[model samples]
Target: MPHRSSTLNRRLVRYAFATLFAALSTQAAWAASFDCGQAKQPDERAICASRQLSEMDVEMAVRYDTLTGLVAMGTRGDMQDEQRAWLHERAACRGDRRCLRASYTKRIDTLKREYDQLKSRGPF
Candidate 1:
């Protein structure tokens, strides 16, 4: 009985260590997702940055859709052009994987221009 108990204890310790290691590795991967700017390898950096941007793109798309719908219903026009510009920029960014950084910057510039235009049109 004592030998059996010792074996069981060993197994439990092994399992616990395994679980801890797995959890740590998972946390590391998640941390990698946020360390985009600190990635050393080009591919790694690109992947990390893409993951971050992809998340932003999804959120921006949702907001853009909602705002555009409001504009269509004449409930609001403040975000119409702004959302359109964002969509355009996101599209541009998604289309070219090689120039993701540049595309993002261009998208920002486009959004700024659209915002300026919308502002000139006066308040909605």
Candidate 2:
């Protein structure tokens, strides 16, 4: 009767929220730093194609951006150079998933170490 209708409405609302959350999570998981629609390079295309690589790209971009913001001007320049070098190295992989994964892993680790060092030196 009325109680059943109320219960059904509550369940419907919960289901809708759950569906929305799941969709957002899935979209976020595949979101990389660069635009997939215009991806031209083989490496870029491969990253766009793979969920795992896309997630790693997002992680690397976030860490790199966060670190760049926190570091001094000179340090930031050096970090940018390092990132450029890493990008070249990653591009050399040219759609090789294993190589791309390894490169991302190494770059992420390096960024993390740098972040930890900055933390140790800072009250800023």
Candidate 3:
């Protein structure tokens, strides 16, 4: 009975790990925030085509969303406005991978700095 229970537990653990791996593999394989199939703009198409750009877009989006949630309403509004402006800047890059990479790097840096500032302000 103990042997059977242990074997069952091991199987459960393996199944859990396999599930997690599949989900992560799928995400990593296509990490863009937007649907690659529906990608219309040249910039969007470039992001979907390149693994690195897709990952960066996902990272930047996560950071922006998280930071916006944490900040005050006024700050959140400003962030949203800035984000709209930044999208235009990104769109301007079009199919230029180097430009897109630089744009994502800059935006990610800005978000990280803001996050650090917010973290420094509290025990929460």
Best by TM-score: 3
For 38-78, candidate 3 gives per-residue lDDT tens digits of 89999999999898999899999999998999889999999
Better of 1 and 3 by lDDT: 3
Give the winner by lDDT.
Answer: 2
Question: Model 1 — which ten-residue stretch has the worst lDDT?
Answer: 27-36
Candidate 2, superposed: residue stretches over 4 Å from native: 1-28
Clashes of each: 0, 0, 0
Candidate order by decreasing lDDT: 2, 3, 1
Model 1 score (lDDT): 0.54
Q: What is the lDDT of residue 96 in candidate 3?
A: 100
TM-score of 2: 0.79
Candidate 1, TM-score vs. the true structure? 0.32
Model 2: per-residue Cα lDDT over 32-109, one tens digit each: 899888899999999999999998999999999999999889999999999999999999999999999999999999
Instruction: Go through the candidates in order and give each one's C-alpha lDDT.
Output: 0.54, 0.94, 0.93
State every prediction's TM-score relative to the real structure: 0.32, 0.79, 0.83
- Model 1 lDDT tens row, 24-124: 66534334323555756544445455555544444444544544553445534656655556546544544355565555556545545554665587786
